[model samples]
Target: ISVWTTLAALLGGMLAADVVLGVTPAYFFAALPRAVAISNLWLALGKSMVFGLSIALIGCHYGLRVKPNTESLGQGTTASVVTAITVVLLVDAVFAVVFKNVGL
Candidate 1:
């Protein structure tokens, strides 16, 4: 699951950067060193877990509140996907902001 999650995040980030930032995959690869230098692995891991928990909690709440139906199940899955993407972006953004601010 961890490997799959990481792969998914890598793909999503690459796509987002390409589409939104006008950065090619090659440029992203070149910029990886800067990303690594700035990111706090431990903090990012903790934040990622927190984000996962929040998503789980939200899904659970919705699951309990809504009727057990195909639509509800689909909604839960969509929520999970959105949560995962949001967490990945949030972590990257935090890393970038901190790196810039601290001159990393």
Candidate 2:
């Protein structure tokens, strides 16, 4: 699901980029392959899997740690969301750094 969502977003973004830059769709599509190599796509997909799982786990962990009180529950839920976002960004940074040499 995440991969599909990412793909859909990528397509939309590509189209938007073309319109914003006043480039022809044909040319944009033609250059896309070279701009984003196949290896980069695969690497992004692979990292998406890792990122999705890790984010889910982080959310679940934080959620399960909640206390019985309503306030605690709210706090836990907020924390889970914030933490998940942080984790995802951190993981993304890590991927950028680690995969830099790999052409991601």
Candidate 3:
């Protein structure tokens, strides 16, 4: 899921950049690799994978804690989504801090 999501995001972003900035596809593709460090790319992929896994696990955890009531189920799902988003943001901030010296 992460791989596909990443691919779609990259493709969409590239296409949008091209349209907005008048950058040709060939030039964009050519400059992409040179513009980004390999380590940074790997770090992004790792973060995405971790975020996906963490969200899934956290969602399951909250989901299983739901009581046998409609209110509890809605509350659990809402909490799961909110917590997952917060966790991802916090993790991203941590990565930004940790990679501050790495030129990420």
Residue range with the least summed lDDT across 10 consecutive positions in model 1 = 37-46
Instruction: Find the candidate with the highest lDDT and give its number.
Output: 3
Winner on TM-score between 1 and 3 is 3
**Number of the top candidate by TM-score?**
3
Ranking by TM-score: 3, 2, 1
Q: Which regions of candidate 1 fall more than 4 Å away from where they truly are?
A: 1-39, 99-103
lDDT against the true structure, each candidate: 0.70, 0.84, 0.86
Report the error of model 3 at residue 43, Å: 1.3
Task: List where candidate 3 sits over 4 angstroms from the true fold.
Answer: 8-22
lDDT of 3 by residue, 48-79 (tens): 88888999999999988999999999999999
- Worst ten in a row by lDDT for model 3: 95-104
Clash pairs, candidate 2, are none
